[model samples]
Target: MGNALRFLYGGFFKPQSDEPDSLGPHGVTISTVGVSALAHDLSQFDITSQVPQGLSQHVVSSKKAQTKPPPKTPEDAAKLITQTLKNHEKADVEVHTGHLAFYGLPLPHTLVEVETSSTPAYQPQHWKFELHTLPVDAKAVADGDGITVYVDARHRTESANVPREVHESAIRRSKARAVKNYAEADALQKNIVDAGYRVINGPNNDDILVRKYRIRLRGIDAPESEMPFGKQAKEELVKLVQGKSLKVCIYDEDHYNRSVGDVYCNGTFVQEFMLKKGLAWHYVAHDQRPEFALWEKEARAARVGLWASSNPEKPWEWRKNRRNGV
Candidate 1:
């Protein structure tokens, strides 16, 4: 009985050691005198009755320790939800439903319905999607039909593809600014700009990193810079879009790799505006929209802008002639 008590005590409370124990073969070291005192103290208790209850309590406590604690804060809750979602395969629809139910969150009627509810539907077949650019600068308007614009990188689809070095440089730049190291920050910013990105001030005066895109206005051809009324066309475009955001419905990429898109600013269709003003041609060879033809005809009838000329040379024809050395 004393040996059994010693064994139980050693199993439960013995300090770990590398050396073999003198009193027992279980690596538990106890002097004879110490064992005598331990047995005498335990003699008062009903050992059989107490040991089972104590062992059961220890087992119960161990099981409780293994259970996960509930999240303590909103951020923690969000993280928990994200982790749970990541654990299941995306195709495990039934499992996801069960998880939502377990968490007492309302399940969506359908995944596709939920996804499409917030996103804009694509325009019928022709255009791919829309790009809402950041505010344009005066210098970015290269010509009447070409402009350079920046899109917020954070919101772009390819933002995740940013190089690790660029990200590191941005971080370093931020730290440099915080420490008032303007020179270092400027150098880092130059590197970011060289990589086709810019850190511009946001509406809240915070820095926003943006990716640059060169856009060619679709369905319109404006005169070359040296052509008659070309300066007026550029000025008109600059007046319309400078310092304003634009909605560009992208159709295709031109040979120059510029995004060919229809530009709209402040509820005005920019191409339509230019065509109606006779600042640009309808570019009928590339686009056959009847409204463009109608707008150009109205401008010609009114004798406004370049339409005031008895005969205006087409910009595309001019370009072709120039290229052919005509």
Candidate 2:
């Protein structure tokens, strides 16, 4: 064990020896003597000084006084400490705090407290967050907490999949159409089916409703499935909702799985976006016109996408004509 003492009242690390002791900031006399297998100089040292224990401290050198080394800047101290720790190949490290005099100078300095830990870097899992029809319009609502929900709906069948409730609900909704009851069950089946649910009637009267969403294609609204954009719409619908869990609210459903609900992807309303993007025209009979006023205005102003045609017929009108065998 090696021991070294410091005296900083005179602005340098003057070693304390057989001389009288001096007072420190705490009003205690700064003097120490220790002998052990693991004691170190508790004082900060000059970089020029070979670490104290490297030489013999037992010699009393009164003939020619040993002068202190140059003062160290905070940056120098930091670099020196880091390098010392890295290069200290021979000794087992032990540390202790020393008196302020160990600094050897009375300069008003700002000591920054730095903290370090050996923690692994964090990696966030990429997730999809979406919102459905809320009180606010799609344009009015912003992302990042506007009724957004996190769902792990995967494109492939995997262990880490969507919530069980989402899957089960989809299966149940899909299977409801297969049930033999057409009278009372029709409306219920339509409601779920229209809400982008795939109803499958299982054995033993069980039903599974799997959710399949849709995409709206650009241009030409064919009559439901026959109109130009009709198939494109269905295909787009599949892109938007199939294999993806969505928050949906239905006004009604066609005999097919075509739903009348507004769809949302990642907190953004797909239906409103489609309408605004001139992908789909507004459903006339279902005149919740207020909800789509902004989108209609946008489509009209752009004169792009589906609105390229001067006087396009509505899907309902086309469907009526088809039914009438015209």
Candidate 3:
């Protein structure tokens, strides 16, 4: 009986070569070749079994956990903003205090303290923050000293405050476009523009929503449209900024509710350009920057632009006369 058992074990469970053996049932040794053959045989069977209903559901839920819906509450919006900042940090993007203000978020304590501590150069004592605007359209130039700008809404805190009707209109516009309804989409876009917002093509050809702002160039006052050199001033400004982006450091809001800021384009100070070109006057009453007066003096000495008239009428004076029906 013992000899018969040994023979059976050697045939079925013993290692077939000098290779290591894999442990089988009851600590019995099985050769690799035998295991491979067994696996092949098992593969021939219906091994493509469906997962148990509960386990499959769990997997579907795990996938769902990877995504989240848009924020619907103030708390959720705040959390999303925090997450966005974190993501920006992770991507090595610079975050400025002014950027926070531009987003309509509260300034950080450190920034608030610094801002209140002392005045900085080229910035007014009441200076608020900077705004890096999107590209400006030719029609956005109201005059040499004023422009209508748009700020991207994707990262702005005020986006949370966007009217529900605007969002619904945008949604409808998108659906209309998807359905090839061009007229409906255009009409919806008109409504959005009337609400102080617009959808424009982004760098990647994607649609981007932006909010509007009227900006008044600080430090100088350009001639009125009807004044001498007025058309030239507007033309010069359009040539400088049409379809170009700008950096605006806001100081205050004017009576017209336009943001009064120092505008820079391609590293050129826009107010300086207008002053040096003799297209505008140094509005000393509003801004008493010595550089502005110096630029105006240089332009006057060169007898360029409005300075060619020797004693050209100022825009303010022109407006004053118009107001008095002179």
Candidate 2 lDDT, 29-105, residue by residue in tens: 33432211112333333433444443223222332212322213333333223322223322211110121223222
Give the per-residue lDDT digits (tens) of candidate 3, residues 1-326: 12222222333233445666653212334446544432332233225422212211221122232244333332333343333333333222122222233323333332222221122226445778777789889999988899999878765544776788888888888889889999999999999999988888889987777877899998899998888889999999999999888877888898998999888887777888898889999999988765466568668868999999967998888899999999
- Model 1 over residues 244-307: C-alpha lDDT tens digits? 9998888999999899988888877788789878899988988866446656765887899999
Runs in model 1 deviating more than 4 A are 1-123, 156-158, 180-183
lDDT of 3 at 113: 22
Ranking by lDDT: 1, 3, 2
**In order, what lDDT does every prediction score?**
0.66, 0.37, 0.65
TM-score leaderboard ranking? 3, 1, 2
Positional deviation of residue 252's Cα in model 2 after best superposition, in angstroms: 4.8
The TM-score that candidate 2 achieves is 0.33
